[model samples]
Target: MAKVGRGLPAPKSKRRVKYGPNVVRLVCEDLASGMTYNEVTQGRGRPSHSSLYEWRRRYPEFAEATDAARAFGAEVCGDRALEVAEQATEETVRKAKLEVDTLVHRAAVLAPERWGGRGAGLRRAEPIEVVFSVRRFEKVVGPDGRVCVREIKPEGEV
Candidate 1:
């Protein structure tokens, strides 16, 4: 048995599925349509989640394609949220609000650069100038042998 994590034997699969272009295409298309990875993999003949991840690790192009698909999916979710909100009836208003909230949250997480809240991806650095004054107290022995305090100011200031 092949060793997996922490010396545990890898689970045996009942079937071996081969990776192919068709699988990639199906996954990307379904994902672009707003289907979750779990949902897409649940279809018949679809690669298992583990297998899909393995393929991603082994293939760079697959990873890039899936990433783009997910971003597109995020936009789809945003659109769906709008549709849900617009079609909400008094009876279904609460349910529609919840659905819209969930979709918006998903879009924010999936494509933060576009749908994330303020400060998600847009930030500008500006120079800040700070001005301050410092006062120093010095203890002095006066001619009367009594201690006196005087305030000393920093250079370039009165």
Candidate 2:
């Protein structure tokens, strides 16, 4: 019969298993290839399941790579939005400048004296006839045709 101490079997060995880079790579590959936790555990010869989970959790490089990928996607989206906003702003400024230029050109051609000189005298023109009204004339049948009375506003009112 085997001897027992403190109701336990005797200690057998103290040698620790050394896992190389290849082993670590194999573990990472198996994890990335859609393997279940149990599958990875079994494939890796059932090494401490908690240890595998801890490796992924504690590795800074792995977390950094994942974060970088997400940040790159966000950067692309942000750049596109920035480009669209810049283009819209440029178009708006261009249209506003063009309208200003057109108004300036029309004013220059129509009344150059107002803009060209510091204190130019404005030219006066005769009042233009706008419309003819028929309210004052009575309707004549065949001979008189229609005599229309033209009405004009007071000089200052116009």
Candidate 3:
């Protein structure tokens, strides 16, 4: 029978799981290996998201490791998707395609601005066409040295 919180349960500080140093390192490695949170927890003493978040906040090294791992994981996903797509078997072609597509989508979501869907700066907007007609305006100067001129903005703004 474990006591609650050591002092009537402080609450947020309550640790859901106790993760050891080696396990933490393994967790980081697993993450870097492109394992999802669920996969990481599969056999390595399943820690909740809150526990992971708390660990990251408490340990700067963990935070950095997690960030790097996630980035690497995203890369792994992209690479695996490409590989799977290229070498899909006939029998599993459909399944492989779906898996690859999912991986690609996941990679995009993980790093949206860099490898995301639709691209970083893509947006939905009405299609527009611009027509340009070049016209030469000869300068006309009066005896008083007054010249006729008009300023042109990029979009024909005056």
Per-prediction TM-score to the true structure, in the order listed: 0.67, 0.26, 0.54
* Per-model lDDT: 0.88, 0.49, 0.77
- The superposed Cα distance between candidate 2 and the true structure at residue 10, in angstroms, equals 18
TM-score of the candidate numbered 1?
0.67
What does candidate 2's lDDT look like per residue over 1-158, in tens digits? 76557688775443333445565655555544434446666632444556555555887664454334333333343344445445555548776555545544433433355533345676757899899754333434455676555445555654
Q: Clashes in candidate 2: how many? A: 0
lDDT of 3 by residue, 39-141 (tens): 7765435677777888889988888888777878889999999899889889999999899989988877666656776666876678999999875556667
Q: TM-score-based ranking, best first?
A: 1, 3, 2
lDDT of 1 by residue, 1-158 (tens): 75458577775453556888888999999999999988888745878888879988999999999989999999999999999999999999999999999999999887777888866657656899999967789999999999999988778868
Which candidate ranks first by TM-score, i.e. highest? Answer: 1
Clashes in each model (backbone N, CA, C under 3 Å)? 0, 0, 0
Residue pairs clashing, model 3: none
lDDT of 3 at 120: 62
After superposing candidate 1, which stretches have Cα over 4 Å from the reference? 1-14, 119-158
- Which ten residues in a row are the worst by lDDT in model 3? 7-16
Q: Candidate 2: which stretches are off by over 4 Å?
A: 1-19, 43-46, 62-158
